[model samples]
Target: MSRFITIKDIARKLDISVSTVSRALRDTYDVNRETREKVLAMANALNYRPNFNATGLVNRSSHNLAVILPFVTNYYFSAVITGIQEVAYQQDYNIILHITNDSPERERAIIKNLAASNLDGLLVAISSDADACAHFQQVIDSGVPIVFFDRVPDAIKTSKVMQDDYNGAFDAVEHLIGRGYQKIAHIGGPQGLGFTRKRKKGFLDALAKHGLPVNEEWIIHSGFSREDGEADALKLLKQKKRPDAIFAANDRKAIGALMALKKSGIKIGAQMGIIGFTNDPASTIVSPTLSTIAEPAFEIGKRSCELLLKHISKRNFIPEEVILPGTLIERESTLR
Candidate 1:
């Protein structure tokens, strides 16, 4: 069997001590630059790889992070993961991804069973149905740094990074108002999520600010899915006094609403204005092209990972709440 190259071999070849080779490889300040360069050059030439297990035994860290997400099949989540991976790669940390499939029970089981010693930190966008956040608190109490993003738990006191959901929703509604769609309705996400409440507040506040009626029938809360959007849209459309515009929680729901309107032979854009959040890739491909409030998904991921790294390095680091702004992309769906 072939043997693996070790620091001892480099030290013997370079006529230096094993400790010197180790410090040189780690780039310790005590090691002279010239010697460190020589050690690195020789190590690279020999194709030597550092023993992570040995290093972890001494440092009490695995230098690996876990990213917990609802799913990665969508463009938004995939983009966020890309951002996270980029940062982790640059920082010399590895990422282990776990998908919860939007199930709270599964999320709880995953967190409860996670091996804390195997990970340096956690970056999570929680499942929508996760009402009990005690598992997360336990993780925090166990001294594992966790930074939440997008779907954060309001009850948890930890670092979080997300888009400005309230402002984005406000802007979306304001845009509809500017286009003279007075009888506007909203199709929102699950009621339990923090962002959903914030977005709904913004929607209601905008309508109240413009002296528009807040019709209870016009507001529908459901899952963040195309089918939920289609059902909610059909309900609003069948009302005795139907809304002239619909602002969906996300692009998927907006597309569903678009489908419902088309099936009913209602003219989109002119007769029934539509808008969504997240600026999902489907927004561009869908008929009429959904207008939306574009979230900084990639930035959210990058910033969340950066914050988690800070917590990992500094045990007593204070929690930070970062909210990035979103842009409104006016598309054919809202052209009036």
Candidate 2:
């Protein structure tokens, strides 16, 4: 006899049909209690262990979901992972994490090699430079549901969850204006991202709303890094007409700007005001604490997972676009 026992062995020992033994082992309500007891007794005697792989094949479910995103070391992404794990544990599902290192090529490679049978769904946050959605479209064509969170692509029609970038940027710029600072400039993220464009529009709209002059040279687009922020700030400082205030795309950049301004012997708040999005903890740790718009990262993860699960359960579920609001935190950086 084989060392590994199967349900067929139990069925034979109990003189019952294979289907009957399967139902009894599953504890289905339709199976009679007497038959179920016999089947259980036989299974125990035969040391029968069910194979999850076989069961998954029969049920067409793996109970596994994948999350692909950039930079897990980032504060915002780490917080989002925590929220995702919470929901996965409660629902008895497993999560498979894939890091793209913020590279479009890596993102595409991961999507290309996904094993459809091993994953029921996916949660994605596209790379900053991802300009195409055909790779994502292939996944959808293969019948795997996807729910995109922050930094999502616009080409595909699917469920998405993210912060209100436009409103957050608008509020950040308006706050600077309210503090009696004019000649405001913006340091934005990569141009390929939708959220970055939205933030830029908000910055321009806010300036136009107050009839403030828009200086094209003052607006700079670059990567979302503290180094980028510092470099962009230095470039602005060198300009003949320097901005009295700046609004960075994120907190890391704002802190970078802070460092540059301090090094240049410029007063942080009085001489120049600065604000950023994403209230990272480093905002408080830095000198002259940075003001920022706080994103609901954890909530975005939880909702994204929940929405993905819904799509898994019902393939025909209509896609939803969820936009969560961000809160503005005033700190020393913006204080006049």
Candidate 3:
């Protein structure tokens, strides 16, 4: 009389035990291939759909992963989500996305009140202003596995996946030097984040390697936005000593710099060279085509999901730190 077909109905029709039918449906090692095939055939004929809720109750796993990030609309974050989807789809897992809108308070609130029973794992990209890791640590203490990606926290002992920020920034700066730009300035993000610090270190080290004096005034740290870049560039233009080249933290900032320079009638690449990190598509669309260092964003996402699954399967899994490389893409912006 039931509209929906259940595994019990298949078991009754096939003259098999309910336990055997369950094992066959699950494709357990103990269930022979012939039995599994028969169960599948019967399930198909009856149009029997799995009740994940019921199964989750018995298996103690929701098979859902949470992804918490700053902004979902950004190109880099969107690309990362694509890669995460590829793996999650293949593995029959679901993702619950949470966007904090770059708010640290919102981020903490989300993690602090997360229900452990509804999720198997978590993937995080902490906010730029997130200064505390206690909320994250609390989740881990509650027995949920977490894998941090991109904007990760330094205080937590967890798995992290990221592109090599230090080397990428080094490459961007060295490229400017190679193009015969002697005086260089760096427009970076917030001073507290790890990636920001790493990128700044790379810029400084590259300058030091080329025997250039470290101009404290030439380096500016602010929010990671196009407007921030424009403001930073305008300040630099007003300086009694302006840099001949600028290496922006990300493409958005670099694009803003380009706009500022163009308005001031400073010919890009000829008078003031520009390079940026993260090969955002806008880099190519902007006039003079901004050159940039491309981070392996997709790879970072895929690897983060893969690593989180390991933690989910094994309670004793050790934490890992993955640093992938970045490639420099040359364009008209950096050409002299």
Against the hidden true structure, what lDDT does model 3 obtain?
0.91
State the C-alpha lDDT per candidate. Answer: 0.91, 0.91, 0.91
- What TM-score number comes out for model 1? 0.90
C-alpha positional error of residue 97 in candidate 3 after TM-score superposition, expressed in Å: 1.2
Q: Please give, for residues 212-268, the per-residue lDDT of candidate 2 as tens digits.
A: 999999999999999999999999999999999999999999999999999999899
Residue lDDT tens for model 3, 219-282:
9999988999999999999999989999999999999999999999999999999999988888
Error (Å) of candidate 1 at residue 237 is 0.8
Every model: Cα RMSD to truth = 2.5, 4.4, 2.6
- Candidate 2 deviant stretches above 4 angstroms: 1-55
For model 3, give the RMSD to the true fold.
2.6
Task: Return the clash pairs for model 1, or none.
Answer: none
Off by over 4 Å in 3: 1-51
What TM-score, computed on C-alpha atoms, does each candidate reach? 0.90, 0.86, 0.91
